[model samples]
Structure formats: C-alpha cells, structure tokens
Target chain A: MWKWLHPYADPERAYQLAGKLLPWFSILALGLILTGTIWGLMFAPTDYQQGDSYRIIFIHVPAASMSMAAYMGMAISAFIGLVWQIKAADWAAASIAPIGAVITFIALFTGATWGKPMWGTWWVWDARLTSELVLLFLYLGVISLYASFEDKVLAARAAGILAIVGVINIPIIKYSVEWWSSLHQPSTIKITEESAMPTEMLIPLLINIFGFGMMIGALTLVRFRAEVLARNGMRPWVRKLAQEQGAA
Target chain B: MQFESISDFFNMGGYAFYVWLAYGVTFSSLAVLVFQSVKQKNKVLKQIAQKLAREERLKQNRSNNESKT
Candidate 1:
C-alpha cells in the first residue's frame, strides 16, 4: 500500500519523480501566469479609485501571500526532517529557502512601489510588513547557517533546527495586519468571505494566486533536486542519473 | 480596453511609473528564478560527473595494488 510512497523517500527515486513533476508544474505555471497577467493587466476592470494602479495587486498579492506560505512550508519540512531525521525533507528545506527569500523581497518591493502613491511613503513598519521583514531575516539566517558548516549533513541539521525554532513566528506574521496598526491592507482576498468582493475582481485574483502557487511548487522541486545532487556529490548513481537527464 | 488610447493606457490614472515599475519588477524576479533553477541543475550535474570520475580513478588505483600483491 505504502510501497509506492516509500520509493520517493529515497533520493534517487525522488530525483526521477522530480523530473516528471517539473514539466507539469512548469507548463501550468507558465500557462496560468501568461493568461492571468494578460487578463489582469488588460481585461480586469480598472479600480474605481486607483484605476490601473490596482493592477499590481495581481503580482503583489500572490507573491506576498506565497512568501508567507512558502516559509510555512519550509519550516514544516524542517521540523519534520529534524524530528524524524528525514534527510530528503531537510535538503528540500535548505534548497527552497533562497527562492522563498527572493520572492519575499519581490513582494515587499512591489508592495512598497504600490504603496508610495497610495500610502504616501516608500516603506512602513506596519504589522504584516514588519513581520514579513522578519520572515526575510529568517530565510537569510537559514541560508547563511547552512553554508557556515563545512559538513553538508551538519549544515542541513543546523539549518533544520533554525527553521524549526523560527516556526513560531509564521502565524504571527499572517495575523499581524489584523492585530496591529499597519498600512498593509487586511485580507480582502480571502476564500472564507461569504459575499465581500464582487466576482469580476475575485476570479482573476484567484487565478493569479493559484498560478503563483504552481510556480512556487515547481521552482521548489527544481531547487530541491539540485540540493539532492549536490549533497550526494560523490554518489555514482547521481552522476548516472544526471547523464540520463541530459540525454533525455 | 478601458483606455481611450495607447498613451492614456500607459498613464494609468497618473500612476503609470509606479504601476509599470511594480509589474516590471515582479516579472524580472520570476524570470531570474527560472534562470537560476536551470543554472543550478546544470552545475550539480557537472559536479556529480567530476566526483564520479575521481571515484573511478581511486577505485582503479586500489584494484591495481591488490593485483600486484
């Protein structure tokens, strides 16, 4: 029953699996984003007040949301790998951190750009924004800690510990906008809302959100595969597998 | 579609710079992510190849010693 699942825990098996997943994710991400971007920028109705300035929401909201979401994923993977000694999970945690950090910066930067005219400033220490700032620090800490160790295994373990300990703050970041004074807007893009937003805006926004999620998942797998190969640096199978990918 | 003309659309209600800038930054970052992933995959493959060659040489040296003995 679980035999199929067990194969994936092996790094070699996981590498093969990543290959299969890569195309599906890449295609979906590429397609969805292409559609969402064109629709968002051109087709979506302009905001009554902000007009086209509101278009940034397509990218901003998705990346901002994914930054938090991806961190949660990294922390959870780190915690599991640390506690259970799941090596693949730790490699994944280490691999995805940098991508997550970059997206977080993108989100913050884009948000700032959007906010400057709307909020009259380039930056703010708002609750969600501050917590997100802290999120970026966590990502950097993980990357730096992993690189600090000369031993790759030890690096993964140390980074895993850091990520696990840092886990307590994710929810704090998510709820910060609700909890404190912030220029950041509350969750207007919630799924739980009964009838808050009109359908016209919500559809395109949701499409973009899912598009970004697919993009993140695909990118994470790509990076994790690299981490696996790098950690298994001297393994014969890794070389063989890579050659196979090159040929295929 | 809402714009009266191409120039009007670019203006984006007097917030064109910020609007275009935000979208531009987002697109560029995503492009970078895709580029880096490809680069990382290629680098790892090369590293693995080098490691495999080194291991083969070490094994060959060990076997030669055994045969002479």
Candidate 2:
C-alpha cells in the first residue's frame, strides 16, 4: 500500500521536494501572520468588555495550536521511520524536534501572558496548562535522548520510541478543558460543528492558525534539508547535488 | 475600536501590560526561530566548505609526495 513512498526515501529527492514546498509556505506564513495580527489588533472590532486586551488572542491561540500540531507532525514522521525502517524519514523526524520544542514553549509562555489578564492570575495549575507543560518535557526528552547516543542508528530508534510514546499526551492536552472544570478556556475552534467565536474574532484566529502552520512547515523543511545534507555529506550524490545547486 | 481614545488603546482597559507582554514575547520568539534557522543553514554551508577544502589539500599533498619520491 505504501509502495508509492519510495521516491521520498532518497534524501536527494526529499531535498528537492522540500525546496519546492518551502517558498509557498513561507509566503503564506508571512502574509497570514501580518494580515491576521493587524486585522485582529486594528480592523476587527474589539470585545465590549475586554477591549484591546482581547486582541492578545490572535497570537496566543495560534501559537498554542501550532505547538501541538508540530509535535504530531514529528511523531508521525518518527513512527513511519521506525515501522518502515526509512532512514531519511527518521532523520526528518529528529530534525523537527528542536523546532517543535520551541513552538511548544511559546504556547505555554504566551498562554501565561494571556492568562494574567483574563484570568486575574499569571498561572493556575489547570489541566490544560499542566498538560501543555508535560508536552514541553516530552519534546525535551526526545531531543536529549536523540543526542545521547554514540551511534546514530541507536539514537534514531530511541528517539522514535519516545516520540511515539509521548504522543499520548497530545490528546490529554487537547481534552484537558472538557475533562475538568479548568480556568483555561475550552477550544474555540471546533471541527465537529461551527466554532463558538464570532466572525469578527474568528477570521483573524483562522488566518493566524494557517499562518503559524505555514511558518512551522517552512522552518521544518529548512531544518530537515540541513539534516539530509549532513547525513549524505560523504555520499557521491551529495557533492554532485550541492555543486549543481551552486551551494558548493 | 475598543477604546475611547488613543490612550485607552495603549492602556488596553487597564490590562495593557499583560496584553502587550504576550504579544511582544510571542513575536520575539518567532523572530528568533527565523534567525536561528538562517544561522544554522549558513553554519552547515561553512562546515561543508571547510571539509571540501581540507579534502582537496590532502589530495594535493598525496600527489606531491608521490611525485617527489
């Protein structure tokens, strides 16, 4: 069933594909982030009670969402690598960890900032917050585990196992609000039905979400490409490709 | 507009500090990500160049030694 995946197994093919994908993602990320932030801060009408303070949601929500999304992306890549023994896939997965960890951190940090104003406290040991914190640890664990090994193969497998195991926390983070009465708000953007947010607020939130996703995508590709180059540095093809691309 | 005046806009109805703080931190973090990625790519390129140059020097040394003998 996965027979069509052979082309991507090659780092050279993956590199070319990554280059093709990044520019579009970068453009979209830049466009959406700027438009979303401006529209939310200025153009979109403000909350009757919260005033401009409500504008913080534009960045806060997007950062929080992408933080989780990036993790899922990495875990899936790791899982594919482990099951299929695809070395390139494993490298891509490992390459994505630091970026994902940083994104997760932004989520928690920004959440606290938003919390201080809206909830009247900088922090509360709420389920959502706690689960997000766990998510951050999971990311760090993967990075450290991957680095700890002397052999690259052992490192890949170890990190892959951690990624797959740690993914159970993602759902816990997602449902933390619904499972308990927490200070952190429930998900505003729902897929089962219409989102609860009004159109004025919703539009900017959606744009920012797409923007953050694009930015993550672009960053992941650039990082993944670097990984491919490093691993394939001794290969005959790496030099040929780099020279032809004028990178040499 | 949520505020009555420019001052109110800046003030954020008394929540300005936390609100602006969130945005400032978020934007800075994203900026750092972009900066680091560029830096990483450049560093990798430099390392690759250094490796290639060293290999060339080693190859030249081997050739010179053989010719001298």
Candidate 3:
C-alpha cells in the first residue's frame, strides 16, 4: 500500500517532489484565501449578536484548526522518522515546527482580538484557551530540542520523542470546550452533524480553512527544501547544486 | 458589498480597530515567515558554496606542496 511513498524517502527525490508541489500549493492558497477573505468580509451576513466583529472568525477559525492539523502532520512525520528511520521524515518534522508555531500564534492572536469585544476580555484561563496555548509551547519545545544538540541524529531522536509524546495534546485541545464549562464556544462547524453556521458564512470559512492548509503545505515545502540542502551539504549532488547556484 | 461606502467598509461596522488589527497581524506574520524561509534556503546554499570553495583551495595547496616535494 505504501510502496509508492518509498521513493520520496530519498532526500533528493523528496526535495524535488516538494519543489514540484510548491507552486500549485502557493497559487491555490493565494486564490482561495483571497476569495474567501473578500466574500467573508463583504458578503457574509452580520452576526445577530456580535455584528461585524464576527468577521474575525474567518481567520481565527482557519488558523486555529489548521494549527492543530499542522501539528498532526509534524507528529506523523516524527513518528515515521523514528519508526522507519527516514531522514527525510525528520527533515519534514523540522520544517513543519516553525510554520505550525506561526499559525498557532496567528490563531491565538486572532482569537484574542475576537475575544475582546465578545467576551469583554482579551484572555481567560479556560480549558480550551489554555490547551491551545500549551500547543504553541509544544511546537516551540520540539523546535528548540531539534536545535539544541551538535549531533543532528541525537537531536532528531530527542525531538521525535517529544513530538510523539505531544500527540496527547491534540485530542485535549479538540475536546477541551466540551469537557469543561468554558468561555470558548463549542465548534460551529461539525462533520457528523449539521453546522450551526449559515451557508453564506460557512462557505467562506471553509474555504479559508482549506486555504490555510495549503499555505501551510506551501511553506512546509519551502522549508523542507532548505532542510534537505542543509542536511546533505556533503553530498555530491548538493555540491553540484551549490555550484549551479553560485553560477546563477 | 455589505457597506455603502469605502469608509464604511474600512470602519468595519465600528470594529475597524479589532478587525483590521487581527488581519494585519496575521498577514504580516505570515509574510515574515515566507521571508525567513527563503532567506534560510539562500543562506544554506551560500554556505555550501563557501565550503566547496575552501575545499578546492586546500586541494590546490596540497597538490602544489606535493609537486615541490
């Protein structure tokens, strides 16, 4: 089943593949996010309660959801690196950490901006909010662990373990609102049941969600290419690439 | 359009500050990430070039010394 994925385990192939996908992801992300933002800001009907302030939800929800999704991608990469001993997977995990951290920060900041008017406060120590904050810290921890050692194999091992252990937080972040009487509202979009949001409002929000996912994918590929180059600096192909880059 | 005028849209129905602030911060941060990633790739490539150049010079020196001996 996974035989097709074997070719990408090689750094050269992985780097080239990421390069091929980057443009598509970048173009799609740009189109979808622009369309979604315009439709959301101008066309979505005002919330009966929050009014225009609810527009922040377009960015906040996407960033919040995609932040978790990026973490899942990172953890899966880390697991693959540890289990299959694939160096490309470790490079991918490293590539994903900073992007995940940035998206998580966007989520928290946008949530705070949204919270001020609706909740009458910029922040609260509610379970949902706290867990999301922990998620940011977890991403930072993985990044710092990977950077702390002189020996990269040891660093990757340590970071991989941390990332694997941090898998417990994703479910906690997802269910925190339901598990506790929290200030953060339960999810408006549901997969198994009808969403509370209307079609006009929900459509742009969903588009932005997917747009954010593509943005993460594009950014991850950019960083993954860099990681591959940095890791394989001694390889003949990398030297040839360096010479070509120098000439260009 | 939800608003009748450009000013009204800019005002964001009286949420101009918060709404624009959130969008501004989010987009700017993403822009910064893009800049940093491209810069990192360039930096790595430059380092590799420098290392290769240094190795080439060392090889030249070694050959020169061998010819002298």
TM-score (all chains, Cα) for each model: 0.91, 0.92, 0.97
**Predictions' DockQ, in order:** 0.57, 0.51, 0.79
lDDT of 3 by residue, A1-248 (tens): 47998898888899899999999999999999999999999989989889899999999999999999999999999999999899999999999999999999999999999999889899999999999999999999999999999888889999999999998999999999999999999999999999999999999999999999999999999999999999999999998999888534
All candidates: CA RMSD (Å):
2.7, 2.2, 1.2
Question: Tens-digit lDDT track for model 1 on B5-69?
Answer: 88988898788999899988888888887898878988878766666667789999999999999
Q: Write down the worst ten-residue block by lDDT for model 1 chain A.
A: A239-248
Candidate 1 docking classification: medium
Q: Provide the TM-score of the second chain in candidate 2.
A: 0.86
| Chain B, candidate 3: TM-score | 0.88
Q: Candidates sorted by TM-score, descending order?
A: 3, 2, 1
Across residues A1-248, which tens digit of lDDT does each residue of candidate 2 receive? 46687988888899889989989989999999999988887777877776667788898788788889988988999998999899888888887888888888888877887777778887888889999989889889999998899777889999999999998998898899999999987888899999987998999889999999998888988888888887777777766655554344
Mark the 10 consecutive residues where model 2 chain A has the least summed lDDT: A239-248
Q: Report lDDT (CA) for all predictions.
A: 0.84, 0.84, 0.94
Tell me the tens digit of each residue's lDDT in model 3 across B1-69: 778899989998899999999999999999999999988887898899999999999999999999999
- Candidate scoring better on DockQ of 2 and 3: 3
Off by over 4 Å in 3: none
- How does the DockQ of candidate 2 come out? 0.51
